[model samples]
Target: MKQSLTRRAMLGALGTAVAATAGCQSPGTGSDSGSDTGEQPESADAVAQSDSVYTNVYQEVADAVVSIRVYAEDSRGGQGSGFLIDDEHIVTNEHVVAGGDEYYVRFADTGWRTASVVGADVYSDLAVLRIGATPDVTPLSFVETEPTVGTEVVAIGNPFGLSGSVSAGIVSGVDRTLQSANNFSIADAVQTDAPVNPGNSGGPLVTLEGDVVGVINSGGGDNVAFAISAPLTQRVVPSLIQTGDYDHPYMGVGLRSVSPRVAEANNLDPGSGVYITRVVSDGPAAGVLQGSDGETTISGTAIPTGGDVVRQMDDTPTPTRQALGSFLALETSPGETVDVLVERDGAQETVELTLGTRPEP
Candidate 1:
């Protein structure tokens, strides 16, 4: 269930978000050479000169932007933003189109066209839409290189159903981890401070050069929003457009990050790594990684004891779940064999496991 951005609320794919609505919410240094240098102040008399590049970018992409209204058989639905990826395909958040079986996409100049879902990936919060009618604006272009922090970004979406609304800002951060609407992990997400209201979820996060860098997904706090990065979009959209699905690598285990108190109470190293709480049946970790064999009391509570602690993966030290997720999402594809270093019994051992394709949730 996707909530309106106006509510400042989020609906996860696998879990429910209990927080209240948040209010609505960078320069390119080289991809990795510099960080965002906070905004500069201008004099009162300066009518902030409008950059010609920005105007050209907007004029180029605006006709490609559309307002998506999704409706179920029961007539229940909500609106979100989307942009044409090509003549017939539009990209939007999975959450935006997941609720309804039918859709109507309204373009800034072309009025409305019927559309159907090509595919929706809950793990990445992305969906591909196919419209029968031809698009008015040119297809969006994406740069393969990552957008660095502090690069100027422009977001054009149908915020609050105001068609073709645009907001500008910088890439605040990158290579971030965010929980998907489905309770899974999305690695290498981009963070921005653009004003993203309820209808901006599927819009394009465009660079000053008019390249699509990210897909605006959701927002939190004041001017803080998260987007699915261009890399993931580039990787998954082709599969979705062709096959109506995408498969991701999966370990299939429940993990809990080690804490100082739990480690000290169990006489184990504190902050050493994450614990294997439970391994799914027939999952990649099944019969390879073991959970706690017993219970241990710590801080007046009995916590699971004797579980295998995973210290690293594929020769890289993944002390945290975030690190592990980054490796799985960004580096490896399904069917790859990886080495997992675990602390079991007393000594350490490396376990070899073949990654599996994540089954549809």
Candidate 2:
């Protein structure tokens, strides 16, 4: 089962979150990057500004931004936020309502209404909700472009129980991988500094123009915060809302970036590709592929290893394991077979390995 995010843990595949309903400060104060107390630069000219970017953004998105409340057994319910993608559908992190509990949605003006999960994908950390009643709500349009570095964005949610709180910041980085509470890596994420907190999970990370670009997920380490990208969400959202799983190719070898020392000891080019750090015993790569074995020393550094150095995935060259993982997701499927090129013993060879099911972790 997915652990609740409130417990400072999460279930595998972006499981549930426990939102806060009370005990929070004004939005920007909780996170240092979002300093609410700072005075705004005011212009003396009459009627400073109107019809600006963020104008009506909150009002437009508020009807769509819902307060999510979930109830589990043992009287341990959780809280989080979600946004409506359509009048009837909503998007949120899978962790917002994991464990198949009863869920409800509360609007800015309305009371709680029942909600049901349409579909959820753990690999992508996305879920869709069907609002029970046909309440009038405005859905935020999604931004088309992937957010660029230094792009201004806003974070909106009920942080630590304060509803209707919003903060602003810029895109810090992209394609970041963070370790989830369950010790699994949430890959290809968007990093921001917009003050995401416990209650902010599953809320919208919108543009200055009010278009949603990502879903706020987590924060830590000085001013670091992160979200799952909207483009990724767009690619996987439909399938997740319709099916509980997102299908992708499964390569059975554990891999890592080939370090300089290991590559030299193995008589291979380190920067040229990723190294298959481990192969599951009797797994797909065991009989068809060759890899490192026994102890080797280079530059007086000893390394115990076994597995092949991957030079390419199909037609694309992969220089790191993370790149290989992203590549695999793009061009493979479960139960498919593909040619893998590997370098072993100062020679390059190719072998076809049938993909296998990703074992439960």
Candidate 3:
């Protein structure tokens, strides 16, 4: 079941707290007590100018952001946040609506409305919902370019059921790999210092200019939080809207970055490329690529050897697993043939492998 405190009741409680604090003040310290400090208050114009960016962004975006409450079959439910992408479509985290039997959404200017899940992708943690009617609010758009590190951004969501709340931070890192289900990783994620808490997932992490940079995924007590990158969102959301699910490109091979130990045992340059640990039988890369066939003890540590080191994929240098994963996720699709450059037997060769759709988790 869903629950919320009315805005009027919340304001009334705040007013009582303020009155109590005022009563506790000393006699001569009141605003009209004639006891004045040297500094004077700034003018309204000055304050307005200083806060214009954040205030304007909130006004532009908050109306489209909605608080979502989900009820499941067993009478258990929780809340999260989402934002409008179009007239009747809302984008949110897949985990937010997972296992829910009924869904309700409340916009800033509208009462709760029934919603239904259009599609959801667990690998990307993105979901789409459709409502019967939508308020007249401009749908949010993703930033055309990837936001650089330190670019100021805002997160608008209902944190801990606090509807229409906003927080500010900067993009701290990008191209991050977030762990997902079944040993898979969500690549090219954005990291931020924004104060995201429970109930914030599925909301838009937007630039100060009101352009979305990422979708809020998870946060912790530490000053670190993460979002699904805009590029990936741009790729996943449309398909989710058209179809009930999104298919992720899969290679079906276990990979590890070639560290110095791995490189030495495999007789390759240190930190050169990604090493193939195990290739799935009868999978996409089964006949095209070769996995490690032997193991060697290097300084008492067993290291897999005799594997094909993937140097590049479709002209993109895969120096690490993150790079390879990103390339596969953003650039390739299922059934697409990709040219893989690999180092085998101290020589370089190109192999073509057709990608496959990922299996259900």
Candidate 4:
């Protein structure tokens, strides 16, 4: 039997490319407009002033961003960029160093150092490296809060292995669910259009003030780019640094968003919750959440009904599979009881299951 690669694994290795050359809005996405010719100010200083917003941000951040060149069994090797998080650690996308036997770090001054993967988390597409502590190398500050839509952002990375490359744009969206190289859907990713491309994965997405808001993860389609949020990094990096992995609570089940047709067939309102699709055998959820079996027709379509619809988790409403996964990650450990509200038999009931820890990739 051939083993199938998970979306998370693929994304961890390549950062999920936008699926098509076409488009997908991903819920809250919208188009942005530029200033019209008439709205443009005549004074050069005015234009300079707006442009200056990103000047210091990039200068201060570029020093922290370093080129990562990974040498694998495959000939030419691969290249990406990462930023210094501290004297001893460098952060980059897991894909950058994937399948590598050796790693190299290069600085803007043409300085180079040998490096190794301290740890990496494929599910989050984050990896860290250990290099000898160097002086005068400043780490970029992380954003304390979520970046808002329209906030000016900048991307500094090694696009196509070209170091010190910089591009600018605004926060295009927030909280998007996208597949990681590891086949797991990374919840709440920050999307930007800072001209990110291959080799940009693992770079820092900085705000106008130079604070790191997100880590570059993937790019494609309509010039879109995605990054894992800083908060998610805050949760995963320490563990990766210490153990090379982070424990994620698991209640083994496959799920999908509840569509209007699914809602109507189940006699529930559409746009309300996520529908459970399958339960992994012997998993934590198997004994806690009951599965229903039937054949039902919705809008002249026949669909199998086996799994339950999840409405909430721990009193927190989970409207989609992404929301459920996000909530699960927020919890601390395995054996911890979390309340899950499910829809069944024309009613809602809460089931408490002690989540189990999934093995790290």
Candidate 3 lDDT over 70-102, as tens digits, reads 999899888999999899999999999999999
TM-score of 4: 0.83
The parts of candidate 4 lying over 4 Å away from their true place are 1-51, 181-183
Pick by lDDT: 2 or 4, better one: 4
Which stretches of candidate 3 lie above 4 Å from their native place? 1-47
Of the pair 1 and 3, which is ahead by lDDT?
A: 3
User: Residue by residue across 1-361, what tens digits does model 2's lDDT show?
Assistant: 1111221111111211122222332121222432466845433321222222232344446557888898988677778888888768888888888885799988777888899988776666778899766567667778887788888777778777677766667789987765543334555678887777887788998875678888888874467799887767776677776775566455656666777776665667555577766666767677776555776766677774556788886887877766676566545667888877888667788888888755543
Prediction-by-prediction clash tally: 24, 9, 0, 16
Over 1-361, each residue of candidate 1 has an lDDT whose tens digit, in order, gives 1111211111111111111111211111113322356544443322122213344456666777788999898888888998888899999999999879789898876777899998989999999999887754678878679988997778888778777667777899987888874467888889998777888889998875678889999984687898999988888899999999888999888887777765764567646788878888889989988977687777788887788888888878877777777678877889999999998876789999899998778
Residues 1-361, model 4: lDDT tens digits: 1122232222222111121111222221223323564454345433333323334455567778889989988765788989989888999988888899989898666578899898887878889999875548677779989999988688888888777777778899987887864456787789997788898889999886778989999995576899999888888899999898877777777777777767766777545787876777798888778654675986679765656889998878888776777777654467888888888767888888888877555
Q: For residue 98, what is the lDDT in candidate 4?
A: 83
Ranking by TM-score: 3, 4, 1, 2
What TM-score would candidate 1 get against the native? 0.78
Score every model by TM-score.
0.78, 0.77, 0.87, 0.83
Using lDDT as the measure, which candidate wins? 3
